[model samples]
Target: SIYRMNFAASLCKRVNIRELVTNVPAYAGATELSGGGLALVFRRWATKKTAGSTKNGRDSNPKNLGVKKFGGERVIPGNIIVRQRGTRFHPGNYVGIGKDHTLYALKEGNVKFE
Candidate 1:
């Protein structure tokens, strides 16, 4: 389109045919070569961009942290009673706390909470 405009501008400057081309109907399409006229059609337009990455690596994986055994549930020694990150629930009686604050059964018994 720019090339056509430059060619038309140069031809118009050299031949002095702007007066004749300006009066022609838009639907006429092209002009006679001898007339040294220009017919321009512009139809380019902006469009919406496609979707990019919807997921990211900033999100961490699930830790699966929570109570594993409920109150009144029977558990043997070494059975996990609760999985936690802090002292949310303190161990009592036959239960023991792990280094990461998890609670496990130390002997066979029913679970309890206080």
Candidate 2:
């Protein structure tokens, strides 16, 4: 990068000494050196803007769906046993299923899958 900057400086000096007065140490001033000629060739080497993404990328919020209580785990009444999108696990004795198909406990006891 240093070599490229030095080369560009020298090239600019060779092209026009007046242009170098403001360009050195701060190429930001290079924009002033205007001429529809070869001096403006360095502009082509300047950084190009990154291409914007064209794909319609999107993502939905996580549902946080999963088992909340495993078998043999202690549970209180109304405690969620499983959170799922469908009837993955049927509600057994002392268990109940919610409108969203989530299984919950109906009584205080150790959770059982069967």
Candidate 3:
């Protein structure tokens, strides 16, 4: 174990990686795991990054309202494809333009607007 650790530490030093192994002594003699040895894995989800000071909870917070449909997605009649304050894309074919300038599917079909 001592020889193996020295070799690994030397290799890591050359590659500029972690050369010092944590809990090396405990792991060096480790073999078969018992039923008591259970490992639990965890993952973190993405969080929004806020900048500057805030006056209230709604200060500089986005409504998270935007496009809901992809170009090749299947849309039903009256299904909103894009939500916008102004006319960004003109409606065409089986699509309709709402008063808010949002684009919605006029019939059941695959979304196919340029």
Q: Pick the candidate with the highest TM-score.
A: 2
The Cα RMSD in angstroms, rounded to one decimal, for candidate 1 relative to the true structure is: 9.1
Worst 10 residues of 3 by lDDT: 16-25
Per-residue accuracy of model 1 over 1-114 as CA lDDT, tens digit each: 999999889876755556545444434445433343554444446788988986666877999899999989999999999999999999899888999999999999999889
Model 2: per-residue Cα lDDT over 16-43, one tens digit each: 6554343323343555555444342233
> Model 3: which residue pairs collide?
none
| Two-way lDDT contest, 2 vs 3, winner | 2
User: What stretches of model 2 exceed 4 Å from their correct place?
Assistant: 1-53
Better of 1 and 2 by lDDT: 1
Candidate 3 C-alpha RMSD relative to the actual structure: 23.4
Consecutive 10-residue window with the lowest summed lDDT within model 1 = 26-35
Per-model TM against the reference: 0.50, 0.51, 0.45
For model 3, what is the error of residue 8's alpha carbon versus the real structure, in angstroms, after optimal superposition?
Answer: 99
Question: How do all the candidates rank in terms of lDDT, highest first?
Answer: 1, 2, 3
Better of 1 and 2 by TM-score: 2
CA RMSD per model (angstroms): 9.1, 15.9, 23.4
User: Against the correct fold, how does model 1 do in TM-score?
Assistant: 0.50
